[model samples]
Target: MDDDLRERVEREAEKHALLNAVKHESDADVGAVMGPLMGDNPEFREHADAVPGLIGGVIGRVNDLEYDEKRARLEELAPEELAEIEAEDEADEHDLPDLPRADDHDEIRMRCAPNPNGPWHVGHARMPAVIGTYKQRYDGWFCVRFDDTDPETKRPDLEAYDAILEDLDYLGFEPDATFKASDRLDIYYDHARKLIDMGGAYTCSCSGEEFSELKNSGEACPHRDKDAETVLSEFEDMIGGVYDSGEMVLRIKTDIEHKNPALRDWVAFRMIDTPHPREEAEEYRCWPMLDFQSAIDDHIIGITHIIRGIDLQDSAKRQGFLYDYFGWEYPEVVHWGHVQIDAYDVKMSTSTLSELIEDGELDGWDDPRAPTLKSLRRRGIRGEAIVDAMIGLGTSTSDVDLAMSTIYANNRELIDEETDRRFLVRDGNEVPLGGSPPDEANPQLHPNHEDRGVRKIPVGDAVLLESDDLPQREERVWLKGLGCFQYTRDTLQYTGEDIEVVREGDVDVVHWAPARESVPVRMRTMEGDVTGRAEPGVAELATDEMVQFVRVGFARIDHVPSGVADDSSDDELVVYYAHP
Candidate 1:
């Protein structure tokens, strides 16, 4: 026997002998009588020598068995008992977040203002997860603030906004309240006036390139010498659209020659001609720039913690200047490194991905390949799995690009059990003489997963198998958890290309079917045309039911119109969403 097998056999034998010896111990004294004969006997002596090590090994094996038997015993248990066990097990495995130790000094209460210029991407996803996590653990509020200050780059209307909310919602995330920068124009304007009255801000009518050059050369602009009153008048004129677009901007009166040019008189507000989505055109013209608007809003909204990406690390400095300028309280900021995926070897960008979605180069934001929340769902990613993934990474500032497959596989492990199992026949062909599916075919559900007790699958004389398996058939094949089979094929029909049909030689074949009429559907994959088949009617499965087709992997129901549920016509049908 191989070393591993031999070790296992010897281990088992030792375990059996120890138990027998222990039971018979009551029959005699060990040192005076039992030890002498047992020590002399070859088998007894061997077992005695190995018993302790084998006992240790047996305990380890028992632990392994219990771990894999998560949902197994439910197959034969009462529903109530099964539920109790499953719930208890879930509670036992529930992971608690590692909350920061509350030092009296560690305070956070803030809004997460994301520019809705594009759909939420990977880095954007992580920020909210971390923010929501901190908000929950620290008793701080996190609001989804639409940073709509810059209309030049913002997408008009609610398309991107709606999608962002949908993605966050799907991931079990929510904010305490929703706010938009556009709603706080008056607030920002008031702050601008405060800075002007304090002689800390001035309006400059420099061209873009002039300001760019000034910023680069660290040279003071001649326009910087104007008094606060004259600067205030120009600021009012700019807001009143007295100045043409991009003609002049209200800039903080910081040292123009400061070593860090970004700290040197950054523009606090600028002119914009476009209409704000949340405000009427007549309501505003000059917009508060990012740092200026964020600092004021953060103080006003009582935001104490600001979690953001490391790319914006300098933002902390600019924001600090704004807070200092206005003498406003600043929030504690946490910046984590951005996430990149190796498959693409670049950062994920919402704007780039949105263009792909708009140009028809990609499906909707939820396309399986897109990496958006919807895409992850379609790919059978589990919420718990995502939580696990994020938790394992922890909060760090080091840059990293983990493999997409690693996260997918991590979530897949959690998803496989929660979902039911089905069989999928890619390029379908039927098997003959399927030992008649029992009149009432009910396979023991998961032997241990009582919550998912016995499942009843339709069995018939002839069952379908995947086309790929037809030509590769040999003498025997196993039908998953079912029995084994032998098979042979007749001259199966084949299309000119590659599709084929085959006879069931002698094998128990298993595959999914509508058991009646299947709902015609298309599935997406990297190579495309993964499997297109009609699914079972919606009435048979629970709305939230997740299932893996035996050979084809996992799938969920898409929200759509079907005869089984809504009365809408086929053409009017919307896919009712489901996931594995």
Candidate 2:
């Protein structure tokens, strides 16, 4: 470590010592002593919140010394505690409670229901990981369900479902089974019929605006007093395409006079003229609403647990009432706060992200910055990193502004160890335009990891180096991980791979390549603008190969087009996501 950094660490350690001294004092006010210590240093204060146990470590270190002696020594000079603080910080990060146990209990089945209107976002990404974490740790089973009841908002494409599956697969989420609300129309119809027979459902012929006004005014509709047989027949007619969209709706029989508007005879089924993605438009005209479908399906599917965001907490109670009305078993409810993105100061919405992608401002659903599972995966973020970040956030009943950096940092730590180093030099200009001399060149494909071993570059009388490496003034410079070199007016000599020779006059010591030898390559990164080249042979690299371009960052070989011979028009494509 640098001297300045070492001194800063030492000062922090001494503060830790002083804080410990005050804590151990007979009649000492702990906060009074530590508050000043924290107030004096921002770094110490920020880390102190996360590393509470560090105080214990500091106390232990001072055990051998007398209390007064320790205080005196601490006051004299600061001590280094960088490593200890970092270790403690890492220890507490992302350690959430174990999932609830279902061993002795049969009531632990849960399902994640996502509307298949678009691809999954980071907010939706949490569902599978959280549910999977619980299922594995608590011996629970998770089901993937599609809430596809609203045909108006639903697109007539299966690509969304396919993309959802792809996102889940990328994150290693495999549900025991998949269910769609559209598939169980009969079950919903049966429940609606039961409600009708029980006087819990009725057909409403009120116009849209009139119904809205009546609902808003907390007044019972005149149709609520209609005979059960009449309402049942009307429901059948609605189902038989006897009514057009918005002409009639099957409203549940609830207290319209009740202050709670949601329970005020809400519509349980609606007539839609639009076609369903899973079922043809001509097959049926009436469809059960979300609440109605969810209530019945949860009972029939034997779901023992309902884990969802806090926004659905009331929906759980509403569903429970339906369960009670039917005398059916209801699942236990566990609701967590919403995952709020700090950037927008609002809940993360897939629709918003999709709109951005559609407009061409964002790359796609998998754009590294898109906050989707596939985006994170393509950015080389491990699933475990996301799990750790979410679980660490803790389950609170209050909304939180989730910072994107937290996940990125978590991802960096998780991926750092697995990434093999490769040198990549961009905007290079130092090497001679002709190439490095045969004797002075010894290029290695993979550094620090020989298991992924060597990829020999064609280093003859022609080669390239990053153009930015060239300094304005002629000076001896190191080629990083390679060796040193000396530069002159417009070029630099190919010094032996290990050493350099000084040359007179100012010259740009930049990353450069032998004119036609090193093939220029392009890549698509999140932040954009990555233009580099490797030996023409790099075009032969197979797709999806993880490689590090020397002096540049690590990248995945995306594809090498066909007909691009090993020695010809090199068209190797590398994939990077905001790598610095």
Candidate 3:
């Protein structure tokens, strides 16, 4: 039994070592290598005394194999190939920005609190990467708190709560804890009472227009001078449903004569009758405002750092009073300016996007035209690329207005190596060949990665070409991977098989698909959908599989023809173009 147990552990250890070697491209540490073995093979734990020696032996053998393979590959590679690999390694070291240092004794804690009013857009997606990076850097805890207090203006949608979580997960960020502001109403109520008892807040029954006039003139409302006992009574009445919506509000006592009008006795809590999607609305009539709720939550939740946009600077200022009133230290606030990619030319607000979707202006939040995170994911943009682009911009205060090319360039570098190449000709026009073509044309799946193998596309006498690719005059053109041809009217005269020959001349290199073997293609770009024809192999791609359409750009398969169980090569292939 002991011998059998030892042999099984040894075999598992060896298998793990080889997997680690391939993953890390080198020998993994014995401690790191043991993690998987112990978790996967409980029998190894039972025979723990023999595990260390077994792990060491397996790691040693794997290291030897890795060294031999690396050495042989180095000998086969050209000098430029070696230099390029070294350069890529160096570039990776500086990909993400260096986080600012924090106090060592402070328990690092970060929160991504988003309002669950609408689906997350590209702008909202930025927070997860930024907050996730800080958490990773400080080895801190991350919390996803839904700020669903405002039901009148920005109404919370129940579906958006799950959608937001899905977006965060897709972006490689998983929260250590999840919370909803509505669930913590009792806590907010307790804090509100504390503020009232401390004489830092009071109840105001002034009408909106009357309060606006007083606030603009830096004059206090008549209710501001009420004693704590009086204010507490009114607050109880407000919470007890005695006050109608907008009839009364709880105002934090800030300097009425303060220069900033917004800072002049801001409303801390307000009466709203609208029922919360996830809560009993009638039970809680007075809801804490955004800044007030955020301040209380931040301190109670032990948030050490707050990363947000610079536009919310006033929020920090307003929350400062509450922090000071309670004698609590505020979290270190890091602010970044807006990131505008003008090429998208769409409104970045979730409310606006929601309206558009409601009005049938957009298909849905995942429509290729929309800049929602789901749309980006559907369009084949990797979450890592989004992180890279955002981190590359760093946490600067200056607003950045860049072209879509900036993001596309960052994304292209990430997907270039992994994406398989396929042919797609838009509005395909038949090109008749003068002579018989080769039986098959094999193109490398990736131009730089030979190990990816080749895709064999059958070649026939007639091929479908993009109508735009055909020149008005007779000229040589290279049909990629097949052969070169010269077009005269409708007939393409055979030139030569050498691509170099066509390259040396004024020939246009174009991609083509076998006329009969081509599948119907519809590519959804940011502008609109473009109808075309793709190689038959494209239909074999699984949903969400990203591929490059030779001169067209990268795209992810959105849908294949319905009921085609195995491969839908003969059916319509729908894809969402990510970027060029």
Candidate 4:
């Protein structure tokens, strides 16, 4: 290869390696480095014999450079410029699916209606991510509506309402409008009256068991054919509190022998005397069923598009009756299958989660074991990671059962570059040094970015090493960047400053912290709390700052040094482990 061509190939290869390493937060593979270089410069392939050597040289050079430097350089570019680059990169991946008939609309409107019975879980994130993307694509409005009408079975909690909103905000969705179903009780009541006057609905006074038997047998209830005048009168009686709970229910008129049993005359409203957490106590005795309230709200709020799970298709059919009665067009509907992550094993239902919390089986909704969004956030899982994973799934109708690794992989891509690195020694064993220890050891804040500066940890004659990393037999080991050491039992005898000597010995390299300068660390892992010791600098980290605990995994600092001198800084630092 000519000198000029060789230089160009080398430069391109270096850029490719740097970008890849920065993105993945790990060493770039030879194939990953060469693929982009070869694609960008086809001429390089002509000299295939020299290509491997050139790529290897470039990779070595790139490895010498710190990741934070590349990240800082990338951040120097304008926001729009960065976005364009990301757009091009994402297009190359072709991960996001195209919206169905996205170009045909002048305006698009979408909503995510979540019942505020409990905090949102990871599954709940799919709707906002999917709907938010469509809203962005078509430059339309996005809304969040709390469907909290049920007070008996799925009662609403004030904390749950706030938590759901907080999760949405963390996911980067700002709703153009917000609605609470309880606040629209008057509107639902008016719609029920309209259905009754139009002879499309009637009040039924059948016992619970009697109605269930009749519906199961495809037989109409005795009151199903009541005239509008009498039905209206009975509905008035229900509103007047003359009917006890489960004794009276307003049913929407549908096919008595509909092919699907669930589609047969569905109940629209029921009498519930339970007090709502937010609304007045027992002020409204009649509560509209979810389908009834949602249908009315969707129409009244002028929702143009409805994207939801395929399981709710029956709900659409039920709501269709009301739409027909009021002479209103049903919004365009699209359904996708459930996105199930069976690796969690834990149930994601709000009612079940509430029970678990009540029984003290969980620390709280934000516990690392729970799949709630608050828990994910506490563990340092970014909203962008959730968005990427959801969008990658697209709108497939088939049910998807994914492993936890699916999300962890997505999260690693986004966090690896940004999260700082720190050393942690769990269940530490004292390793006494033979030679004099240096006063301080400086390690780069990030391996790939030297320009980001170093973190200085005070050194001593003894260092804390993870119990697992203790040498079982005499062997040469590298004590990270500080120097080489000869390990024998609990002794880490200083040998030389050259890391190459330890690397050549074919021994394991382990991370350690100076015994005197280290601070206690308690990480809340998915399994349980793991106590350890981390470098003193770890205690200085700001709340919510994500950091990789060297061999331990990534974690988010949950507690930091408080301003008051309460000795909290001396206490074990608390963190929530994100993932390995």
Better of 1 and 2 by TM-score: 2
> Which wins on lDDT, candidate 1 or candidate 3?
3
- After the best TM-score superposition of candidate 3, give how far the Cα of residue 244 lies from its true spot, in angstroms: 1.2
Q: Which tens-of-lDDT digit does each residue in 486-563 have in candidate 3?
A: 788788877666654542334556788887777788789899989887777887889989998876778999888853
| Candidate 1 deviation (Cα RMSD) | 12.5
How do all the candidates rank in terms of TM-score, highest first? 4, 3, 2, 1
Per-model TM-score, in order, reads 0.73, 0.75, 0.80, 0.83
lDDT (C-alpha, whole model) for all candidates: 0.58, 0.62, 0.78, 0.78
Model 1: per-residue Cα lDDT over 356-379, one tens digit each: 878987777776556566666665
Residue by residue across 472-517, what tens digits does model 4's lDDT show? 6577766664666777666877776664343233545678888877
> What tens digits encode model 2's per-residue C-alpha lDDT throughout 100-129?
444546646778888888888777767777
In model 3, which regions exceed 4 Å deviation? 1-101, 279-283, 472-474, 495-497, 562-571
Best TM-score goes to which candidate? 4
What's the CA error at residue 469 for candidate 1, in Å? 2.6
Error of 4 at 507 (Å): 3.4
**What TM-score does candidate 3 get on C-alpha atoms?**
0.80
Candidate 4 or 2, higher TM-score: 4
